[model samples]
Target: MDKVDIQASNANILKDHGSDNKLNVSYGGPKIGRYVSASSNISTGYLLLSESPVGSVLYKDKCGSHCVYCFSRLVAGYPCEACCDVAFCSPICRKKKKASFHQFECRYQEFLTGLGISSIGRLALRLITSKPFDYFLKIRKYLNDTNETLESNRSLITRNLDVIQFNAHEVYEFVRKDNQNLKPSKQIAIGLAIYQRASYMNHSCKGEPIFDNYGPTFYFKETKDRQKELKDRYWFNCNCQACQENWSLLNDLISIPKESLSYNKKLKQDSFKDLIHFIESNYVDGKMPTESIVRAIDKFRTVCYNMGSVHYLNK
Candidate 1:
C-alpha cells in the first residue's frame, strides 16, 4: 500500500479500537515507533511525541512537598489526610489522582515506603493495580495486529514484567552530603513516571532533540554525554550522531573558522535574534526540519564560540 493509504488504514484501525488520537504507534524507521509526525514532509524539531504517564510514583523521602499527581512544588499544598506523606498543588489534582490511581496506593503507602523498591517497581505495581488484566490483553493484541517487530517476543507480558523487575534501577542526583565536604554525594531518586510512548525513544549520547521533562510534557535539547551511565543501567549503545561522531569530530564539523567572519556587533545581534525567532516559531507547535534545525543551532553555537563568548552560547 502507499504511505498515505497505510497511514489512513492505521488511523482507521486505531479510531475503531478507541485508541487516543493523540498517540500514533506504528511500524517504520525504528521498528515499532510512536511518533507525532503524520507525514514524512513534516519538519523536525517540532514537539512531535507526548504521552501521559501510565503509572507514576513520588519518592518517599524526596519531593515530599511536591504534588503527587502533577509533581508541582508548592510552598504550601493540600495534604493527603490519610497518608500524611503525600500532598497536592491543588484540590483538582488531588481529586484526579485519587480517582485515577492514588486510591489503590493510598492505603499501602506505609508498606511501599518500607519496601524500598525502586520507583520503576512501584510504578509497575501501580500499573497492575490501576489497570485491569484485560487492558494488557488488548494492548498485546493490538501490538500483534500492527505487526511491529519491536515486540516480536511471544512472551510479551512476561517481557514487560521482566523490564519492570530488572531494567528499572535507582537514579541518583548530585547533592551535598555534608556541610564540610566540597564535593557532593549522589542523592537517591526523587520520582519516576512511565510513559508508554516516551519509553520507545532510543538512546543517543548526542541524540537530537534533547529530552527534558516539565511536569509530564517532555521537550528536547542537544547536549553531550558518554552514554556510560545509560549503557551500564539500560544496556544499550546509542548510535545517534553525537555518539557516532564524538564531541571532537562533531565540533569540527559545525565549527566556523575565526578568520571567516569578524565579530560584528550588528551581525551577531541579528543572527542570534533570527535564530531564536526561527526556533521558537517553528520548533514549538509546528513541524521543523530535524537535521536543519540541529545544524542551525550548532552553527549558532559555533559562531558564539568563534567570537570568544563561550558563556553566551548556552544562554
Candidate 2:
C-alpha cells in the first residue's frame, strides 16, 4: 500500500483507543468491572510520557514549546498548584519525578491548594507557569472567569496523574542526552516527541520515515524498512497519512538548514501527493539489499534540515 493508506490506518487505531491504549489493567472480582486508569505511566496522562530512565525526559526538553492540540497545553490553561511536586497517579511516581520539572515550581503548591485544584491540576499549572511569560499573556485574554474557571480547571488537573515526575534532565546530563548509538528510528522517535510538544512543526507530502502500524503498536520507520523491518509488522496503528509519507517531517523541523529554508520559502510548495510520488519514485532502490535502503533513509535525514513549514511552524 502507498503512504496515505498506511497513515490513515494508524490514526484510526489511536482514535479508537484499542488494546494498545490499555497498557495496564487491575483485575477485580468477576462480579465487579475492572477499574481501568486511563491516566498511567504508559498512557501519558495528557502529558507526554517518555520511556527514559529519567521521568518525563521528553517533557522537559519540550516544556517550553506548546502545541495548541497538545493535552498538556489544554491542561496548562488551568493552574495545577496542588500537585506541582506530586505525580498525578501514584506516590512512587511522584517521588520518582520530584526533582524533575517540580523543583522549579513546587513552591507554587499554594496556588493549587487555595484555588481547590487537584495535584494533577497543580502539575499542569506549574507546567504552564514555567513556560515563557508570553503563554500566560495569551491565557489571560481567554481566562474568562477567574474564580469559577480556575476552580473547574483545578478539578480536571487532579485526575489521572502519572507515577513518574516530569523531571528528566537531572538524571545526570550524560544520561539525559540522546544516545547516539541507538537505532536511527528510535532516536527519531525520541526527537519526534520532543518537537511535537515544543514546536508547532508542520508536515510534508514528500516526507520520509512514515508512521505505520504493525498490528498493535505505532511506529515511524524509513520507507525502505517496509520490506525488511516492517515485514512482520501489522498495519493499523497509524492514522496520519502525512506521517506515513514522511516521519522525518518532524525531524526536519528540528534539523533544517538556515539557507535552504529561505530559498524554499520562495519556491512553489510541494503538494502531499506530489511529495509522496517523488519519494517513492526517486528515493526507493528496489534492487539493493537492506544496506542500500538504510543508506537512502539516512540521506533523507536532510529533509528535516530543509527549509519549509515541515521544519518550523509557530502554531
Candidate 3:
C-alpha cells in the first residue's frame, strides 16, 4: 500500500472526528463489530482512519539499524547521543523519543540487553514508564461509570490491550521489489503497534485476488472450509460480499472490466504512470466513481504482481 504522509493536526478531514463518518461501529462484546458507514459508503481501497500508536516498541535487533521512534531506516540520523545504541530518523524524533519513553529505555539499555529482553517485554516496559502514577490515579475516578469506555487500570492511558494476541499488528518495512537496482533485504518484523481502533472486516474477506500483505496467515483454503478456519484462527467471520456469497478463488476469477485485467497478463512499462492518470481522472473530491476503485486497485495489483513486488495485498 502507498503510504501517505498525514498528521491529524494538518489533515482537515481528520479533525474533530470528521473522518468518523467512514466507519460504523457497534458494541458486540470484546470483539466490537465495525463496517463501512452506510452514509459514507467508501469505494474500494479507501483509507478508513489514521491512528497514533498508544504505545510502540522496536525489536532489540532493530534498535541499531532502524529508528527506534519512527521505525524508519537509520542513516546519519540521530542516535542516542549518550549510549549510541538506539537511533532515530531525525533530531526531532530523537527529542520526542526521549520525552515519550526512550529516556527510561536509554538508561537501562545495557542492563536490559544483558537480560535478553524480548520485544513484548520491551513494549511492556515502555507502557510501564510511558506514563506517570498520577495519570493512572486521575483515570481511576471514572471506574464506577458504566458509560466510561473501559474503566480498567491499563485503560488509564489507552484502552486496555491485555488480550494483545488478538490485536497487536507486527509491522514490516517492505521495499518495492519491482526495481532491479534496489537491494532486496530479508523481510523481518521490526516492531508492533496498537491502534486505538481495531483491524476490521477487510482482512477476512474471502477470495482476494492479490497477495496478502499482512504477512502469511493460513493456506488459501477452499471456500467451504475457509470460514471455519478463519473463525477458528481469528475468532470472527467477516461480512464482506466475498465471504457472504462464497466467491470463487483467483483461478476461477473474472477481471474487473472482464477485459482490462488478467491473472497471467503482463503490463507495459508505463502502467504505473497510466494508473496515476486513471486515479487523477476518476478519484474526485475524495471518492472514486462507484466500482471504479476496485478497478483501480485490481489494475495496480496486477502491475505489482507482474513487476515481482512482494505479493501481500490479498483482495
Candidate 4:
C-alpha cells in the first residue's frame, strides 16, 4: 500500500495514520490515529467530507425493535419475511438491506448474538460485509503475502481495531429520552456510527454531541451532577462558564411553551436551508463564505433549550 503513489483529495484535511497506540503516522498529531486539519488557504464553506461513514450496523439489542437496515424505530415496521429476527421501517429499507448486506448475514442471525459479539465486533462484521468481495480479496492477499513482515501486519490490525471500535460513537441523538413510545429505563444506544472527520474535533463541556445517521447513541442521564456525568461518559471536565460559576440548571428559566419550543426548533431547521442556499449561490472557489458559515454555527445557539424540552422536563 505504501508503494502506491495515490493521493486522496482530502490529503490536507485528513490524515490517517496506522494506529494511535502503535503508530504515529500523522506527523505532530496528538494522541493520534487519524487527524483532520484544514489548510490555511481553504475557504470556510469548503466541504471536508463529501460522503463518509465507512460502515455501520444495528446492534443485537436493537435488532427486533429497530430497523435492521436503516436503524430507525419500528412503526409497524416491515419484517424480513424469511426471519423474525429483524424488521425495517419501510419496505424500501427492507429491500435495500436485502440487496446490499442483510441477505448474506441473515442465516447467521440465529447464532451471531449467541456468540456474544461486542459493540466493536458487530461494527467490524458490518465493515466486512459492507465491502465488495474484491476489497476483501485485496486485503487478504496483502495480509497473506509470504514476504510480508509480521510488524506490518500487526500494525495494520492494531490500527483497524482502534478505528473500528475505540473511536466508534453512539448515534441515538434524535431519540430524546422522553420522545419514544417504547421507553428504555435510561439512555439507550440504538446503534453505532463512525464519523471519522469529527474524531479530530475537540469536545467542549458546552458543545452538543456530534452524531451520524448510521448507528446507536445515548441521550438522557441525571442532570444533577452535569460535570460529573460529562467526565464519566465523555472524558471531559465541565469547566465551561456554567460549571465554573456554578450556574443553576433552572436559574431564571424562561418557560417556553411546548408548542413554541417545537416551532423554534423547526425554524432553526429551516434557517439551515437558507444558509446552505446562500453558500451555494454566493460562495466562490478559493474564497471563504465566512458569514454563511457563522450563521450555520450560530443556528445551534438555541440547542441549549434541549437541556429539558418541556416534554422531557414534564416527564
Candidate 5:
C-alpha cells in the first residue's frame, strides 16, 4: 500500500473509536490529546495534566463583566456562562478541575440555569444584541450630563457589576486540590489551562479570548509556586470597569426568579396578543406563530434588554 494508505491503516488500528473511553463520553467538537508526563523543563512534583479549553465559555474566555468593546460580547452577545465559569464537557472533567475558581461560581449554577443560557451562548446573545456605538454614546452622555467625579463614576461602575474581580491564588489552589485524583495529564485547572499552549494570548482592555481556525491548544502555565505567583499573573487585578460594578449586576440578576423567566410550559399554554406581533416582526419571514418561537423571541428580548441592547437599538 502507498504511504497514505499505510498511515490510514495504522490510525484505524490504533484509534479507540468506540471504546468505553470514547463512548458515552462528554466529547464536543473534537478531542485534543493532553499532556500527562512531567516536563524536565518545569518539573515540581505536582502531576500536571493539560488539555484545550472546552465548552463555549472559557474555551472562548467569555467570563468576567463587560468591556466597552468586548469583542466576544459583540460576537456572542450575552454573559458567557461557560467561559465566565470554567465549565467542563463532562462530569469527570468538572470533578477533575473543581479546585479552581469554578468552586466559587458553581454554587450559583442554579442562577445561570434560570436564564436558560450557557456561558458562550450568553456571550453570543449579548453581542448580537449590543450596539457598541450607542453604548459608547451613552457612556459619553453620562459623563457629559452628570457632575459626578471620575472616582464616583468608577465607584458606581464597580457597584454595578460591569466587571468581576476574583482571587486567583484561591482559584489556582482549588483546581490543584480538586483534580488530585485524575490522571496527571488529564487534569485542567483554570479556564485558561484548557488549551495546550497558552503563550499566544494577548491581554485586552476590551477583548475576550478567541480560538478559531486553530485546533484547541491553550493551557495555563504550570508554575512551581502557583499560589504565590497567581495573584500577580491573574488575568485581571485592577479595578477594571467590568469588576467594579459587576457585583451589583449579579445581585440584580439573582433577584429575579428562574420560574418567572421561564416560558417552556407556559408558551404552550398561553396565547397572548403581543406574541402574534413578535412572531410577525422578528421570526423567519413572519410565518404563522408557534408558541415555541414566540417564547424564544420573548427570551431574546429580555436578554437584549439586560445587556443594554434594547435601548441602544431603540435609539
Candidate 6:
C-alpha cells in the first residue's frame, strides 16, 4: 500500500474520546477492542481507528533527515545538539520531546545506538523515562480493574518497569519487517511506538482496521496480514474471515469461467487504478456473489503482482 503520511491527514481524527467519533476503545476479555461507535455505520474502506503516539522511537539509519518528533521527512533537519543522531522539523517539537523523554535518552544515545536494542526496548525506556512513578500506578490501577494484573513489588515504577520488560519481547516480534534497507544499527532503531488505546487491538488476518504510522501518529484504514506472522508474534490463533476461509477455498468457489479468470485477459486500459476501480465497483461491499467477490480479489492480487504493486495486497 502507499505509505500514508499520517502527519498530513485530518488531525481531529486522532483526538481521544470525542463524542461524534467513529472509534471507541472498549473492554473485551484479556484484550481491548476498538469498535465502531454505536452510532456510526462505516463503509467497507472506512478508517476505524486513529491513535496519536504516547511514545515513539526513530530508526537510527533510515531517519537521519526525518523529524525526530513528528517524523516528517525533510531534505535537511535541525540536528539535536546533544546527539548527532536525532533531528527535528521545528524548534517546538524538539523542545517538547527533549523536555519529556529525550533528556534521559540523550545521555545514553551512544550505548543505545551501539547495543542495537530492539525498538520495543527503546520504547520501554521511553515509557519509563517520560512518565512518572505515579503515572504508572494510575495505569496499573486502571488495568487491575479490568481483570488484568501488572504485578510489582517495591514500587509502582519498578512494577511497571518490570511489566514493560516482560512485554517487550511480545511487542518486538510484531515489528514490521518491511524496512529492508536499514543498516544493523539503524535496524535496531526501526520504528517503535505505543499509543495507549491502540495497544489493545486483537489480531485478525482480515482485520477491518489497518494502521499506517507517520512518526507518533497513526492513520487507520479498513484492510487486512499473514496468519503465521500474527500467531507467531501476537500469540493468537486467528479466526478472522480471511483466515477461516483460506484463499484456496475461495478460489475454488469462483463461478466465473476459467478463461475470464486469466490474468492475461486483455483490457482496454491496463492500469492499477483501472483494475482497482473495476474490482471495487463490481465486487466490493457484498454487491456481488461471494464467489465473485473472491474472484475479484484474486484478480486484483494477480494484477498487483504482475505490475509489481504487491503493496496493494496489504491494503
Candidate 6: list runs displaced more than 4 Å. 1-26, 30-40, 132-190, 203-225, 249-281, 284-315
The TM-score measured for candidate 5 stands at: 0.17
Query: In model 4, how large is the Cα lDDT of residue 307?
Result: 30
User: What tens digits encode model 4's per-residue C-alpha lDDT throughout 3-72?
Assistant: 5322343344443432121111122333333334323333223333433566777777787777877666
- How do the candidates rank by lDDT, highest first? 3, 4, 1, 6, 2, 5
Which one wins on lDDT?
3
* lDDT string, candidate 2, 184-267, tens digits: 221121111121111111111222221112312112344445434434432223335433554342233233333422222221
Residue 68 C-alpha lDDT in model 5? 18
- Pairs clashing within candidate 4: 170-217, 171-216, 171-217, 172-217, 190-216, 191-215, 191-216, 192-215, 192-216
Candidate with more favorable, higher lDDT: 2 or 4: 4
TM-score head-to-head 3 vs 5, winner: 3
Q: Candidate 1, residues 150-221: lDDT per residue as tens digits? A: 754567545655665432333333333343432233333556666654453331122233332221100132
* Candidate 4 Cα misplacement greater than 4 A, ranges: 3-34, 38-52, 138-148, 151-160, 173-188, 202-315
Candidate achieving the largest TM-score: 3
What overall lDDT, based on C-alpha atoms, would model 1 receive against the true structure? 0.50
Candidate 3 structure quality by residue, lDDT tens digits, 64-115: 8788888877757676787877888898998887777766677788899899
| TM-score, model 4 to reference | 0.52
The TM-scores, one per candidate, come to 0.53, 0.25, 0.59, 0.52, 0.17, 0.55
lDDT of 5 by residue, 208-276 (tens): 221111211111212223323534544323332223333222112222233433322333312333444
Residue 216 of model 3, lDDT score: 23
- How much is 296 displaced in model 5, in angstroms? 40
